[model samples]
Target: MKAVLIIVLIIFTSLSSGKKFRWCTLSDLEQRKCAELSKTLTAVLPVTSIDSFARISCIRAHNTYDCIDKIRVNKADAASLDAGDVYSAVKLYGLTVVAKEIYEQGNCVFAVAVAKRGTLDIQRLRGVRSCHNGARWTSGWNIPLGFLLARNDLSWDEAQPLSQVISEYFNASCIPGVGVAAPQLCALCQGQKSYVRDKNHFCETSSNEPFYDSDGAFRCLKDGVADVAFLDHLAIMEATESEQQEYELLCPDGTTAELSKYNTCNLGKGPGRGIITRHNFQKITNKFLTMIQRLFGRKGKERARFELFNSSSFGGKNLLFRDATQHLQLLEEQLEIAYVLGLDYVALLKGLGHEGSSLDNRVVRWCCISNAELRKCEEWALSVKSDPLVCVQGTSMVNCIEMIKSSEADAVSLDATHVYIAGKCGLVPVAAECYGQVCAPADEITEEMRNLHLKHKGLSPVYAIALAKKNAKQINIHNLRGRRSCHSHLYSPGGWLLLSRYTVGALENVTENCDVGSAYQNYFWKGCMPGADGNLCKVCIGDSEVEGARVSSRCAASHNEHYYGNMGALRCLVGNPSGRSFGDVAFLEHSNLLWNIENLKSSGWAKGYTAVDFELLCPDGTRAAVTEWAGCNLGPIPPSTVMTRPVTVTKIYDFLMKSQEFLGSKLDSEFHLFQSQKYGENDLLFKDATQYLVPATHMSYQEILGEPFFQLAESVFNCTPAAWNHVQQHPPVHITHSTELGSAVLIACNGGFIIFLGSSRVNALD
Candidate 1:
């Protein structure tokens, strides 16, 4: 059944989780401005193990899930008291030691408590009845765990479960501490045992009704049953006002002293709070610096920035300003140029020579269509000309030319920037926008790299299979001979080459014996290496290969805007907040996660790929003086917009319902366009746009192309009409209109992007 559960009570800010108490420490009590600044502000409840207090306020505040905002829960600290809180701090777990210390010192203390009625030390009752909430209490759990173990000389497993202990106390043992209720029991411990008759002492409904309790141990002390009550500093402060009037101080070793029941307390520190936003923290770092200056003067501001330094301010999302290596990469490729008003007016191009040379390899294509690490060779070399144009901003012509001329590639490609740079270099401005795109470091195949692909014409699968069979027969002969197989293992490369040939000759076709299988994924990390123990077992290749996925890209967090965004961008889906009962806590982590999934994901139909904006970095720290687009594929993300969470089988069902139409549409469109044209009609194909689809209904190539399409096809370019040579070739990204190739949709069986134009039934999506 479909379900929508509204469980927002688990989320909220730490401060307003409950009514103010008095047993809190002096510093803590001061921050609890419930008296002087008593403004009832509504906030989303943060996810908490015990969020009853915050839940009450949230239900009363907005009352509806849609209107709720600003979550209030304990700050996420990896060292905090709960596993749930630690998990929520996902990325925040990397904060430095000092930051962790500060966070601990604040609200979410790392300490727990030991309580008996209200008195902490229950030494008098060696075997008394003890009962209270389980270890769910941060303070109640931690303090007591440590304190009780030391005093009783016992470990956790050595201790009995509460129910069992209570049972034994009544029947077998004589322990004094018993029952988990606070106020009713605390009243008895504090000297007011009469309150045990009332149920209100343990309830949150009405304080006047006895069960209308405030703080757990505080009530135990209030009712006069216990001597000492323990709680975290934040909880202690928010619940009370008599700062020092509560409990007496205890030693770090857990020994307690008798004093006022609500006076002094012991506590540990925790990490503190800060602001969160979606923009790249570095780009607006200057603005952040200014904000700090205004808020805390210079030193405090600087310190604040320092505090946030390693906390996502400059991590995985941008150019490596934080990491020295990344900083160096940028320094290596930057080009500084200025555009004059009118002097520079021609396009400057990076002259990567056209295809066919060895040195002409475009190691990194700045024009990444939401992808990087140029796939297999050839295509990798011609990546420079992928994108059409880029305009560089510059100061003066002289400055621009110096920046442009000094670049690693050809002249900076721009209508004006190149004009000035070329002028400075004495190379007069030629034509602008005439040539589609210019490439540099013209490809020149080197002998060595070429040797890697040169076919020595090794044994084909067919020949190998025949020999393998013969070899397996010998292995069977040995087994049938009943001779034991030896297990000793040791071999040098020279020995292995000699031994391998024999082994291959013998076991290659062990398939005849039903024992043939691949070692490792058959490639990549060559099967296990030999060691003293033996030859490491190579991984067996299964039915799968290295998977490829594409998701929203954080590869460019500096720029959140996706270019040419279209319907495909809808692939992004907002996630349902968990742990947080509060509806309004906007976790940029969650939101950004969603944003990236959507921004980078597109159906095959949504060729709306995005690329990163980058300047060239050269080997020498000087600007390669190049600027262009680049892409980084952020592996497969949520298949559907609704899958804001990680991939799940259930989520796939929903994604398909919404995005099925895009399947095979790109190839289908090519087919339909080729089919739809009637002779003599104006051509629908336009060079300006990469995507072409009929408006009303989807059509196939066979269904669309007619006499008009054939006539239209003839007017534009000559179609080499030599019986359509139908052979698969690699991607035609660098497919040149050479005399030998003719006008054909060359497809390569081994290429990354599968092309299915000529095939009658096949379809391509990658």
Candidate 2:
């Protein structure tokens, strides 16, 4: 592995927890003392200190220089340490012997186990998200792997040392004379070991190289290259942006799942190792120093350090627990926080569903502002009463801060550069920026906020901030000096360029140091070519996601009744707005659903879908709301319909039925609204579908091709202009056919022409 020391130096933007105060949180006296001390402190840095001896130390976000100057028994002077060693040196100088930990914001599972079986079992976890940071792995990948392997009838002997386990799996899956089966795992390493694809899908070592190692382990979960992945603190704060989305916290035991029925057992515990503060100093301090000396003692201290950096060894636990008191108080903290969230046993059960939740039911509240800008933000925050965590955005810096102080919001999520800048000024940044979109800054500085001036005001359009649920993400601290950019060239996997969001973050803002959490960039105001400066985004371009939004138009249901389909049949299934317009791939798969113009563009279905498929189709000039009457006697009857089958193959009949019920209920309340004011209602074509669903016999697809509606199919095919459509249904009509075209009729015909090809018509064509 060539000591794969790819240092990815990322600025740590973790919060000290809402209850745990960060530096900017210093009281008046603390702040005054700290500022006075800063004059004496020369070297201060915000980073974790793990010595060759494995001693841990820390300083407040903005109190670095001053913290060093205060020089209490546990504090070290800033000037005494190197740029990187400042924190550790200060700790040593102050004689502080406390051991701290690096934890992720949210984790899927935290497994700690000896890999006797050797296999990194990813197979069992199909849909569940796993964390990337490995700190909690004992509860995450390891234990989960064990449970799965055990279930599959494998023991430590069979799974041992990853390599053997993967090979054994390959052999078992392969039949002697049969052709190779599609591998359940990623590509194979030499012999039986499983390997992962790099950013580019080219063949290479997986988790084989140090920097790339975390990726391979994560890839098992990320690209579905593997069933599960390993995560630790570094993976969270430091992984490239693209890696964030594939996972989230493991749902705790007895929690309900989004799908499925029946109660499931808890996968594991939901507790965390606390930063147990050491209230009793003298005794603990002496013991901690001794441990540090052992770390430096000539006998294999180097080996011990490896354990500290890598969560693969129990040796790592020593750094976390040695001098730190279990802070038994953390138990109270945990209980109280849970209470604040209003979590209950019943809610847990409902959340877990039948599968049993594998993740903690608790959610972490992550605020995006940097630590340096707390004072202004806090003052602003104190004034607001609504959401506690806020992603601040606006034309004026004062306004942004005022909102925070006025109880208008809590955290101000922002880019790393802005976040860091805020910390330098005095704010508590809970989580680093991951990825998400926002409107870009104006071309010129229309406001002080955009210009980077703290005290200025007056601005342009304020970008909208959309926050992900608190529990939905993970947080990590990065070490910028160590990055794997070098190996990306040799390890391109799947034809994708691999770059961390941090790397891209640095590139996007022209500001070299920055951080963030999660992934996605549509609402981003930074990172594009003409963005904040020069920061690049660590995202796979060309990929699209669907987002749904509220519109000015109200649901078309009459007076009081709620109609599920009235909001439109596809409402629940619709994704984010920027989602790629319906294309060939999604359309054929969901051929039965009704869609308007927006659905076609968003789903990428416009390329092949047709208006004839819609229950009611509208063109660009259609009205948003209308009332139509049927004039023809035959047309006065309820409309008819034909269904091929549920398009979602994986969904069971029950799920499909659920979807129908869900959509059908909206029929009255939601409707296809037209844009035009005055439109024809006297014609039979204007009649609303009276019957819920009229069925028709199934016939050869060719028979469908011969219907007069096929001519109108061109209009459906052109469904990209946000066309509106909504129609009631008729009774079910089923028809079976052999090799030839079968008989069918277009009911709900609105006197619309029916062009059926029977024997005589076919003979004429021949």
Candidate 3:
């Protein structure tokens, strides 16, 4: 009786202590395989005394994202994810890689471009028809595209969809899942195009798309529909002898080699699929994976009963894990997705789906502040039929910046001051407005000038001048204590920051905290400083009071205010169409000074005003003609930059460059991108004086602004505690979940199993 009681107690304790790991399944077949594995694990539990061995349970998820969500919320514990999905899970969802599937090629695969012998050279593939396994596929898309981008063979404007660039690069392609977004990419596809009975599967990411996976892509090349096929090294080896003999691997060096030379001639190498779970659950998940591999792996004691890696019995291919996976290998160290996947591969993946990299993938949402800019943006959207643009409205410039940061809007063109603020909030400049003859378009640029162009492109610095009517000689820079003023907007580099630092900071006994805004309000008697309240907004007039216009827009820091921007400030000083001037002095940018005067005269806003009527106030309290702004300005200000999330920098740059090519000049009678006079606004989307949009790619905000200007901005803004707090709050996205695993680790195959290793083993499951 005592022995039986002891045995019962031990059984009860084992049942209570056993942990049930819920494995997430993506499809019905995966669910079936997971259930079978669970039952097999349960059956073997009585024979194993390992307390850490978890009993498996199946949890069905809609897809990889759903699986990640489930694991994050603790509804599921683990799932096997592809390299791309693994990156998303780890970086975005904070999941950790516990183990990886090792195939004959170890834990990584080589991507190769395959073509019929002498069909085409790798470097000269610009206008050829191509075949790809699928969109975002590691071997077919990411690796090859990344390789081309690195080689400068392919140019990506960070502002547009990568698919657009690919579609334009290749004359035609059979890129699965991309036909809907870019139809030209699917021109070579051989799928059923009829929609009857749901038969339209053209360029779908399935068997329906004749050129879908590695096999399909290879078949595309074989059938002569595609000149080249992008796939993994294994795909070529899996091809028939005759097929392999006919196809040759295209090397990165613009040469070709036999199919067997994939190891030496390949686009790039990328990591294989891996199992992921919540960071805190990595240890238990690793142990559970280890237990399953020991039981049903290739050399498992119960291999005859069930195979862990094989899913053929369940009427599916790669159901729970890849069919080619030899065995589940536990990572000795918890490696980051970037380390597991090569840095380049990780970057490519990030560029595909990083924060602010438009989720829609079809249209870029340009944030427009005020009705006038929105009207112009809407017109711009209508004109660009090829690349659709969606106009999103914000009440103020700062609001637009916040919208972009939260990804509500994709991009916005900002002045130097706003650009600095955007940079602090993790935004980057994609393109900059070039306002003079110094800027040149893409076709006109030569190879030798490319480096210099890239560095100085869009960097046409403008003079920040304090403009006053020639008749108002009493309103000099030194004695403007009680004078009414007109400013471009609050925090504007040219219109506000420079003026404040040199005049307010130097003359006024303001505190070190740099409350320049308050000092400006106290110093100037009345002013039209958009975004400021009280006396600062007293002299401001809101948008031409149309029937339905918002009266609250009077003090808004956007085009909604009649007294906004360099042009608006000029308008305020010269007077509106009624010839009722509001201020004695105006602070604005000199690059647009003459242009704004011309626009105001043409638009009949300041009909009689000319550049001769305006004079720039010098630091020496003397006045100079508007054309002599070179020496009379407060300081040189950086040109306005198109700012976007760092990840979408290239995409934004690409979009702007393309847009400029299509609708940049005023000569495009249909619509002019730089002219906003017709919309009853000045510099709605870009400054009217902008000669062209230049690439600011690879240039940081500091580099774009130059040290002198950047330092001047910092001094005026005071690098406030709030800004430092924001930096601390939002560290670089990549380093947010970084773990300090004692030493650098790498994966290697040893004794027929793959394992992560440093100098010493950390958590070897075997």
Local lDDT at 638 for model 2? 10
RMSD of 1: 32.4
Task: List, in order, the clash count of every candidate structure.
Answer: 150, 188, 10
CA lDDT, candidate 1, residue 192: 21
Residue lDDT tens for model 1, 1-766: 0110022221222223344211110111222321111121112112342333321111111111001111122111111112111112222232211111122121123232334324444443334433222122324332333334323322222123433422332212111122343233322332123454432222221112221111434455445544444443333433334544454445343466333322233432111111221122212222322332232222332334232112133222111011111101000011111010000101111111111223222221111111111121123123223322222333222223333332222222121212211322222221111111121111232323222221221111100000011112233211212211111011211111112222322123322211111111121122211111111222111111113321222111101111111111111111111111111101011112222333333323123323221122221222211121012110111100010000011122222212122322333332322111121111111111111111101111111222332232222111221101211221111121211110101111111112223323222211
Per-residue lDDT of model 2, residues 364-457, tens digit only: 1122122212223333233322323223433222223223322233323322122222221222222111111121322222323222221121
Off by over 4 Å in 2: 1-98, 101-121, 124-275, 278-661, 670-766
lDDT of 2 at 132: 23
Q: lDDT by residue for model 3 over 1-766, one digit each (tens)?
A: 3443344335434444456778898556778888888777666555443343345678876446668899999999988875766777777788888877777766666788999988887888898999998777777777777667644577776556778888899999998766477888888988778866355666765555667667678889999998999977766765678876788999876799999988788875666778888888776666556656766888777778889878789986667787788877677566655546544344446555543343556578899988888889998888877887999998676777766754568789988888876675446678777766666664465434444654754355788888888888677888888888889887788767788765666324434325566667778899898887778888888865633555767868888788888878887887767777588888888866677788876877767778788788999889899899878889888888898764455556667777877664335357888777788777888887776666776577778888887877666544333222222322111121222211101112122111211212222111
Worst 10 residues of 2 by lDDT: 488-497
1 against 3, candidate with superior TM-score: 3
From the highest lDDT down, the ranking of the candidates is 3, 2, 1
